[model samples]
Target chain A: MAPVTMIEAIREALDEEMQRDPAVVLIGEDIGVYGGAFKATEGLLAKYGWERVIDTPISETAIIGAAVGMSYQGLRPVAEMQFMDFIACCFNQMVNFVAKSHYRWGGPVPMVVRGPCGGGVHGGPFHSQNPEMWFVHTPGLKVVCPSTAYDAKGLLKSAIRDNNPVLCLEHKFLYRRVKEELPAEDYTVPIGKLAVRRTGRDLTIATYGAMTLHTLEAAEELAMEGIEAEVLDLRTLAPLDREGILESVRRTHKLLVVHEDVKTGGVAGEIAATVNEQAFEELDGPVLRVTSLDAPVPFSPPLEEHFLPQVADVTRAARELARY
Target chain B: MELPEMKYPLSREQLLDLYYFMRLTRELDEQLVRLFRQNKVVGGLYSSIGQEATSVGTAYTLEKRDWMAPMIRNVGGLLVKGFRPRDILMQYMARSGSPTGGKDGTSHFGDLQERHVVSPISMLGDLIPVMTGVAMGGRYLGQKLVTMTWIGDGGTSTGAFHEGMNLAAAQRAPFVCVVENNQWAYSTPVARQVPLHDLAERARAYGIASYVVDGNDVVAVYQTTKEAVERARRGEGPALVESKTMRMKGHAQHDAAVYVPPEMFEYWKARDPIARYETWLTERKVWDKKTKAEIERRIERELKEELEFAENSPLPEPEVAERGVYCEGCHTIEARWERPIEQLQPPKASVQAAWTVSDFGGTNGGGAAAKAHAPEAAEETKPAAVAAKAAAVSTRGANGGTKRSARAAARPKRRR
Candidate 1:
């Protein structure tokens, strides 16, 4: 298999799923003819036809609602948000309807609401957001953010096949920047599992999405300075993979959570709390977080660099945690 | 009251069935209210006292294979769709044997496989898009089924309603939306909710056909919905049937509806749907006094047994609440494909690659201009239950009414 970008991997996952399962369909704004705003669905409309590759109105509520409905009729619908920030438009449908359908009525809402998220391209507040925590806070919804092309393809395939609603948050920054060769045979990276990106001993830096790249970069920098920081990619957020976090923390004796989302109500807080509650005795130092400031994403390059946790931020945080 | 000349081609038996369902709906609500007053109901009770006709008539037009999602007040529709009184009672009481296994209360339960009923969400207009999806999904799965859902005047104001309706119209999805313009949405009146007097006009913006009918008139509701369902089944796209009626009770049992003027209640009381239908049946000689009495007796007896069964059903175990959050090998959902499954395969599923650039000439692709690529036409199969129902009505003789009544008197209703 040849090397593929994260966007290409996502497109292949959708294409293969549609080919394998007759019930799979895609719905989103400008997804059919205009090929998606990000071109994640560039040629799907031509390949699958308009019936399967639906170009829905600019109605997030309808896109998600219709996908939930399609799931009821046994069709696996992969809906796109154009940008994840617009998912707020259909929050009621996602939280009140899709998330609670199974608990409320023993019904299965098997669908995926995937879109590009995270800040780095200066998309400002609306277009750039790490909104995985919104659905992560919701029960009955599985949240995943793939940091690499392999996980992006494999995880997306798993999300489509899962019998419950899953939110696949793809970071726009890593869409083209991250590329890797995938296996020729079909495979799926299981949901609710974390991936170990780098092996070390001094400290553990847990991150996901595009932040994984920054964390890994920081680990490389720290390794040169004799501070070996293990990198744990928290791939699945909702089912927080506590064992994996605890296992790495137990070995390293220190933990640092890094994320691009804002500090307050961010997933970093949840990770820190999980470590404190479950692995309190295993930790030698307080679980530190290298998260963006508690403010909306700024559009300016310098402001965004300051707002988002850079590789320097992770390195500084990991160095301090390793000393403790 | 003088019943108008029979407008629709409804046989006497079918007319009698409508009356029975309306009465059953009203009677069931009365029992639910009593259960509420007795503190047996786990949640608030929503009474569909004055709006029985709309639910019954529209649901009666649907075949068994079709799907529908009912609002809190559309219990009549649930009954017509074959949900027993015990099911509603157990659901309200949060019994272990309820539809949702005591997971939900009130009319928030739906049966996907057998009855094809989708549950209603607490957020009002959400079902519109969901039902539209169900309609489109069914078409893709090669099932010729029409999907229906209800919305109140206030719910029509939600963004979901507009978005869902537009999606359905754009896809030419086989969907029928029945707007129960029940004058008031919760404490808010329709006047305060929307600028248009008729909510059906909202559908016109989407280029879908719309109708305005007397919701209190059962015959009119049935005929209008039948027309809409038939049109949708014929691949003519979605249609909206705005049935105007009044919410005879408060939004739920908790509110006293103090905001409702006394005159409004008096006005709607005189036009009660069940009372009007009873009078119509008597006037049209469809149901004589004896037949009506027999029907009422049958309803009371059935209600008593169902209520007793509901009362005896136990509450779910505390442990039961911990399970079934995510479908982990517990429930499997598979669509019942009516047409050949191979149609969805490769060469048959291939579509033309040409883009019709002329459709979006003047706009930025936001307009509902190009409704190109309507669902591929499949061989139509008439719903078996609908055909059987029609056959049953046509074959009944003069003594058919008495015969049905006698059979009801002899047979023991099975308990769910």
Candidate 2:
């Protein structure tokens, strides 16, 4: 009934899912007693107890690998990475095993690896990261980055219920920043559907996660200048809502993608290429992107601020595209 | 410890069964090698030649509920766990009807539900954590099951080995980590791989009970693994069993093993597990020449039937490649995006103006949400200035200064 923070929404989703399904469990460092580095999993241990909310050692390989094994035994495990930057440690497990298990053997790994991702929190290279592209490039994995609390809860519920391994990337910047009134009744946002956060006519700003907020701000700023910019939230990266993206681009005839991940090899490039291949005739201007610099997330506030794409950056990109 | 006086833990029938399994595995390895040489096999064959005892012995001790994560050299273990030889042959032949559905050939085969086996990942030691988690999940679910996973001597050097073992030990998971220290990790010998003489000693770092057994002795391996499995089922936590054997052949059929020391090969060859077990069985009067001949003939007939089945199995259709990349009911991003753009929903008009920080609840919320952004921060900086700074940074393009040539130039010159 009331608006809840993204972190709270995530916590509620885990809490409700564990209650709904006995097979659902939680495993991660400091997740049980410490709540979590960001407290996304706060009160989960207290609610579900230790057996369901397991506190694992600081071993990402073991955490992910064990989650894969647990999935084989019919248990739905939601493993937290504390911070998404550390997920690189278990890259082999995720890329080689978890991502390939379904394709390799037709086995369904009903597991979710959720954690606070994205820069802007000044967590440096080790804590702040938008590594969704890594898993997006990997097949057999569903990647989700919800911008609002409602989507955070709904998408997580869907991810937990889905048979494939899903990477739920929560932006650290939006954990407490984004809040929305959620329905009391249980609901799940389908993994492949795109949410049209704000509709417009002149141009389309296709983005997700924290960038959605900045892009929305940019859209509002452009709207004052008589430019109606549509904001499309790509809730799920892998199994991307291609229909939503193409349709928005077709109407606006202009596209500007935004993301917090590094520009090189980011989802922005993929979207640009897709539009270029499928809707090249509709485009009145070149597809553009406002993404982080191609470098590790700097720890200093100023450097991180410069490294990350801001509202002003999106506004500049959207205005330039609107003119064309 | 000295080799225990060939005590029989199993009855005559079980012993005969074990002997038959070992003989069958040995024959299969020989057949695979011959097939590979004749250019009939699809992939490189990695045999369990001298290490059949280790696989058969440990796998035989596992109950139906227990799971075994085997490596390429654990075909014997797979067979002992009730994996039909014909299915294994079908897998190697890359038939559509194979368990892997021609997805993976050779030792990359497993049946999680039917056979209780976790499919192997080629990145050695990775399966250790997987097996540990399976056991931990089993214990948590109130199932009385023990999980055993195999790794090579070289695998112990990996970071995953330590992580998996430490997790298993700390969690007190019902896991048995079997390190098949068959001396060589590919071409690298154990002596060169680690400074320590015994790999079992590494387990002490995790504070788990460890044992080193004579891998060449089937009875010793079975007895050692049985005790470890019993301890695990008793909730005593994980144990490390190092089966010290040697790789008598090259890593795979492609390798001629010219690098191997002739004397070293001869030494391990003299102590072949199958030959030693045959002698032990004959001495105990549990097996005779007539029984051995009959068993060999039976295995030969079975091998012929399996070969025919593999030959008769059809090759997968070309379209099958696009399938099985994801599980059934799973929709890949590529598949969804492949649809034509015009058929999708038409974009709608904007419902509102630009969104502001306040809309995200800077004032409406309290505590962390309220203090989420520093007050007056927006007024302090101009949007034009920030946009200018961002534009300046964006000009550098995605490839920054980490060019390959630059990195190579930074490397120190090597000494001749």
Candidate 3:
């Protein structure tokens, strides 16, 4: 079998799940006839017909709110946001209603909000964003960011099957850039497990989403300089893989967190604080992070490049940490 | 307009039931206000004092399969849709037996499965889209269900209101949007919310049918909403019915309503919905003084029993806060990440082995070659080349007489 791109993997997962469960349906703008802004939902409208593949008006509030109503009626709706940046429009529905419905009334909202996210695509502020931390801070939502095609397919399937609200943030940069040969048999990656992309003893690079590629590249660069940098891909953010993070910190004794979101309230800060509190004794150096600047994603290429964390940034951060 | 001597569409027994439910809702509102004054109720009371006709009339038209998304002031609607007096009282008391399991102790209570009622969120106009979605889902499932959602006059100004109305109209969804133009939105008068005289006229922008009725008259409200509901169920599309009424009380128990002019207050007070309904019923010989007194006594007795049940209901246990944040059997909340770091197993062999470049088909350099490469040379030189290449491509697209340039040049300037 040939390796499939992340977009193909996600589409295959949606197709298989919709075939496996009649309750599963697709709802979003341009998802039906247009096949999606990025074509991640290509071929679904042809297979599922109009009822299952709905083309909704440009209303995030209605899309999310309707998904919640559908979930209440025992349907598993997989809603697309075109770009996750527009998800802010439906934050009230997601945080106030979809996330808390089960907690408030014991009505489990089996729904998945999937979209292309991250900063490397030069989609500017409106299209490119890594807003997982916003949902991570919100309770009653599971946030997943898969770097590999296998994890992208498996985690999405699991998210569709789970009886709670899940935000599947697919990196736009890796939609076609990353690829892997997925098994023909059905499989699902558990929600709370972190994948150890690389292992080492000198230092650990903790990251997820598109940053995993940069972190892995940095590790390759660091390995040449006699520094064995381990890379930990935190697939799930809300119910974070605490065991994997602590285990890596214990083995490497140093931590460098990387992400593409702004620095102040990003997941890196959370990881740094966690290591500082739980695994402080094992650390030989201060917990450092390589993240984007504290500003909106700029549309220009140079500004965006500067605003995002690059492979060289991770390599430099890893080199400084390895010495400590 | 003169009070029309219109014929009643319902039977005598149905008219009596409507009267009884309206009276019950008013009594419950009065009780809640009394409880609030006595410091027994947990939150401020939002009463449906003079607006009972709108809720009762609209909710009475709904079938069991149909859904009603009510606002905070729709206690009458909730009562008509199978919510017991005891259930509402228990909810206000914040008891363990409440529908929200004591999580939300205010007016945010509904039984989605039993009565198809969407619990209200605090944000106005949010439920419109939710109810529209419910209607869309029902229509897709081929069910003859119409979703009715209520909003105040001020809520019509919200972006969500426009979105919901536009989507419902565009999709031809089975939805009935009822705007309770009760003259005030939390002390801001109707004139301040919208410049137009009639809120129903706003529905014309969505190309949906619209109607305006005297909301103080229960029969009128029932008739107008019945037509809207029937039209929606027939898949004709959404309709907006603006019920013109007045809020006889302040927005809630906490307000003194001093902002209202005395003349205006007296004007609406004379057209009180419950009293007018009583007069209409009495004129038809369907209701009499004896029946009214008996019904009042029955409601009073029922209220006493429900109040006792609520007051005696035990408070939730301390650990109950830890529960209900997520669904049962779902993943446990990782509270503070308390697992011991030392007990976890070491890195697996598969992950350690996958780190080598050989596993990646060696497209990139192996360990030794990557180490000997100068870091500055590799870091500084590669990205510069890529940036230059990208910049040249973008510049060509911008100025080289291409189709992309025409689109970019023709693009309108965006607002800040």
Q: After superposition, how far is residue A5 of candidate 1 from its true place, in Å?
A: 0.8
Candidate 1's C-alpha lDDT?
A: 0.85
lDDT of 2 by residue, B99-205 (tens): 87888888777777768888888898899899988887777666788999999999999999989998887677889988898989888888899997668778767
lDDT of each: 0.85, 0.80, 0.80
A1-324, model 2: which lDDT tens digit per residue?
788999999989988887677678788888866788888877766565555667787999999988988888878899999888889999999999998887776666889999989888778888888899898999888999999999999999999888889999998889999888889999998998889989999999999999999889888999999999999999999989888999999999999999989999999999999999999999999999999999999999999999999999999988898888
Sort order, lDDT high to low? 1, 2, 3
Off by over 4 Å in 1: B1-8, B357-371, B376-416
Pairs of residues at least 3 apart in sequence or in different chains that clash in candidate 1: none
Instruction: Kindly report which residue stretches of model 2 are placed more than 4 angstroms away from their true locations once superposed.
Output: B1-8, B330-416
* Count of clashes, each model: 0, 6, 1
DockQ of every candidate: 0.71, 0.17, 0.15
lDDT of 3: 0.80
The candidates score, on chain A by TM-score, as follows 0.99, 0.98, 0.99
- Quote the lDDT for A186 in model 3: 96
Q: What is the TM-score of each candidate against the true structure?
A: 0.92, 0.87, 0.86
lDDT of 2 at A194: 89
What's model 2's overall lDDT?
0.80
Model 3 lDDT tens row, B239-311? 8888888888888887888998989878888888899888887777787789889899999999999888888
Worst 10 residues of 2 chain B by lDDT: B404-413
